[model samples]
Target: MKRGEAAEDFPPLSPKACILSSRSGSRMNSTELGHRLIRHYPFASESLLNERGIGIYVPPSYYRDENKRYPVLYMHDGQGVFGPNPFSNSSWNVHRTAEELISEGLMEEIIIVGIDNYGQERLNEFAHPLQSSGIPGAPDIICKGESYERFLIEELKPTIDGLFRTLPDREHTALMGSSMGGLVTYNIGFRNPHIFSKLAVMSPYFVRLDLNTLREIPFYKRYPGVNNLALWLDIGEIEANILVEHVRGVVEELIEQGFVFGQNLMYYEVPALRIPRRIGQPECDRRCCFSSGSRAKQLKPSCTAEKKSD
Candidate 1:
């Protein structure tokens, strides 16, 4: 038998094993994974920014047509976007989700840019500089969110726009993530409204040590006047209530700042089981997640967002 055909010719040990082997044979490899993924890595020039690389997901059709321009969504927890790896138990299955969405035409074809985090510095980089009390075990580390934002706006965005035919306007730009990444989604969207018009925050880590400082964010003052911004906020009910409450507090502040519930903001609490397999890995025991958005015109709010507010 030929070397490539050897496996196909091998005798099966048992019916069950045969089935399992067949399934394993169909598994995707890294290159195959890359093709299935809209992959791109853009460099950053900011100092101390080691993980300045980003992975972008363009739908399969994106490669076939040169004239297509797609919306752009920036996601955090780069390693967790595609599949479970040795380093992470949970993944967003972003590639699979994007493929499905593109196939269904439910959403406009989009470009997903996964921003890899600098592990130890992730917490610091994602949190606002003034908000630091809630993050445990990192009292001395100063927040670098401002610098991180600069890297995205001044460096990453321009690079992505230049390389790909993306809709480079605020209405088409979005930010998303879970946990700390979720928090950053809200912070970045609100802080830089001109750049990001859509915000998706899943299971945000809002209970940081300095939650109080977020109240002073300037976006709060400018939110009401902002147009075309949509917000999607979802949280798991069984995860950590402290985090949920913190998210609620932030939403309240935004509301107080003049954002209408269902107009500029949409929030949801998803069950642990139904929580998208990608966002919470099979091993993750938490049962809920949360998210937010800015552009109301572009988003068709999910059913979960209509749930009663806490």
Candidate 2:
């Protein structure tokens, strides 16, 4: 039930192969729903540890409302976000869910960008650079996520912004992922408040709650360039249960650092469950996102307000 346990077992994938790897004919299922789920290959990159493909989900409104600029949500583990999982043959169906919400007027129109992991290197690339103590189940940081973070800020975001009609500001952009991906989301999202102002840290394996780790976190004071960030943090029953306490520890630290609940920071947990606002409702999206059976409007807040970098 650890972060990398389930998906990591897949055989190591070749970076070159992944560049060409993509789902069959459904490439860009220009669906009847009016939404287009497009998969583009050969997204060559040198800054990242591996060169890979990109999956872009353009909302129906993007096509319908010609002049509008949409917010962009960047997600990790492209395969699980919307397509069939190689391991379980299931998927997040994010495209369908987002479409429903937008159509129902429950959420704003937005674009989704999914980044495929390079198999084994996923853990290394996704590792958040923070280390206080070793996590029992979580793997130790291998590559320390520096390259991955660079790939996101330097190579990936710029490319995505250029090609798509994105808001291109911190407030209009978000970063999300679960488990290990969640850890890196905080590292990248919180650290780079000037770029990504929103974040969704679901079932993050914070690993070490030790004093040393807490001291290393830079959120103790109001960080410059991060004036108005809306953050969402949560965990579930099975896979996330093991790391729940650590998750709480991180939240407490954030709260002490001045992130107000119900305003900019929202934390949800239940030996039992899962945000609520029309613009960035976490509760509405919980069922739509975590539960396979449930559907939108699931609004997972995963972006940041743009700020001038210091």
Candidate 3:
């Protein structure tokens, strides 16, 4: 199956009408597994796009250490990340997962922002502009990716940095997403290297676009800000079967551009883990921390990390 084919078919959603549990605020109220999940409902923007929700997961140390600051991870597909997202009812359960990891000392404490996707507009917002070489099954998507990128960089990011105690530098910042979300994560990370240095692109829907067109994007053409990045790229066993060539093409290009596979750039193929949320379990979380301009750790089982030699 093409990436995000299942999510794209779901009905459109109005931002105000979705996730109505709380009001927009500076306070952190929601709780899961001893961590705070703050809900900023109807997070309005100056742009024409609908007002979306923001789910912020503050680490356990957030309250305990008023003087301490944590790194931030900005994630796409906000709704389904922290808990049962409104879309698939399957969530990344990031709150619980991160709590476990922190307690076990597997990963450091960081603030995770879940930026909600605009339901039906997800395909358009997350997609990169493709020429006539778009994939056969992929729809003709008008790339609002630039606008979405602006929302994260221009709007939401400043708000989070100002309100929360974040490191606020490119080295301490990261971006992660799955499927279509994954596609945008890589795009935004590459384009805005000064903003985010760590990237976890899980089951990226790169197969939706022609390999040649993808290679022509700025990161490939100019290689700007890529070397400063610690990128974790992965595809599911099933998805890998379909996108092996496309995924491999991107990996090979990154290698050619001086991304040492097991060191700066990490690539993996996970078996029996297809669901995007499940694909982002603790293992991925651990690697994300390892990628966050910190010491690298050994990868876990069931996930294959490939090292490419120049």
Candidate 4:
């Protein structure tokens, strides 16, 4: 991926979309809608990503502690994280899970930055090795994981750390995503192990699993410091046919490279999830496992934002 201009090159977000919604709402049952609020930033940036949206979730503890610093989890596919997906009309309810986990002391209060995917460019941005398309009007060149990774590590991470009271280190930073988002999460997180210490990839989309792709990663040779990195990789047994075999191959390769289970890696093959396209159940247990590297964790997104209601 090529380097681009600075933040000024991108357009500013819109007022309406950037509306900081109020978190002052009544609580609902866990199965009901997520009670946590989402702060949307429309037109967040188009430099390397889609100039569409950026959603942020702050955990409850953010308001209680003024001097505490927290870890950060960068998630892909912003629209599906907290709000209703226009297509599925369902969300992962990330906020609700975080709230419950934090209250129960099962998870540490952390920040979640949901990076939105571009419409037509979503595949390119999340492409692991620059895949191409057959549809008409599609660009002849069809890969963009590199540029997208740069956007997250170089641009987004810096801005977030500087703004939020965060533990700004690779050990404290994590990546989470499902499907295509999972694909990119694997790409970016592993490629920059020095930048991201943990990852939760759900049903990662890989058309094929090949050793060549694995060889290209430049794994330990580049960043040997994180060989013991924490990873949570999973796939539903009922997942689409294309994902099943590929996930296995990826896992096998990861193991060959010294990623052990229980110590630095966690892999699960379970029943179909509520929203197989996005995440697991609504209990927040899956969310907790993905964020904290421990099956025993969860979080609240209350980050560095000036605690205010919209």
Per-model TM against the reference: 0.70, 0.70, 0.78, 0.73
**lDDT by residue (tens digit), candidate 3, 72-180:** 9888888877777766767777766766667777678888888888888888888655444433344557677778888788877877776678999998899998888
- For residues 1-310, what per-residue lDDT tens digits would candidate 1 score against the true structure? 1123211111223432221122223331222342363343434345444544456666555756778888887878776665553365766666665555445554556777777787788877887654335334446556777788887787678767766778998877888877778777777787788888777777776664446554322111224454445677767767655565666666666666677777667755666623432454321211111111222233433333344433
* Candidate 2 lDDT over residue span 91-165, tens digit each: 666776776666665566678887878877887787744444322334444644777888888877876776667
Q: What TM-score does structure 3 among the candidates reach?
A: 0.78
Candidate 1, 297: how far from true, in Å? 15
| Residue 296 local lDDT, model 2 | 32
List ranges where model 3 is wrong by over 4 Å: 1-35, 130-139, 209-225, 280-282, 291-310
Clashes of 1: 37
Q: Which ten residues in a row have the lowest lDDT in candidate 1?
A: 283-292
Output the better candidate (1/3) by TM-score: 3
| Candidate 1 wrongly placed segments (more than 4 Å) | 1-30, 34-44, 131-138, 209-228, 273-310
lDDT of 3 at 16: 31
Report every candidate's CA lDDT: 0.58, 0.59, 0.68, 0.62
Q: Candidate 4: give its CA RMSD in angstroms.
A: 12.8
lDDT of 4 at 299: 28
Clashes of each: 37, 19, 1, 9
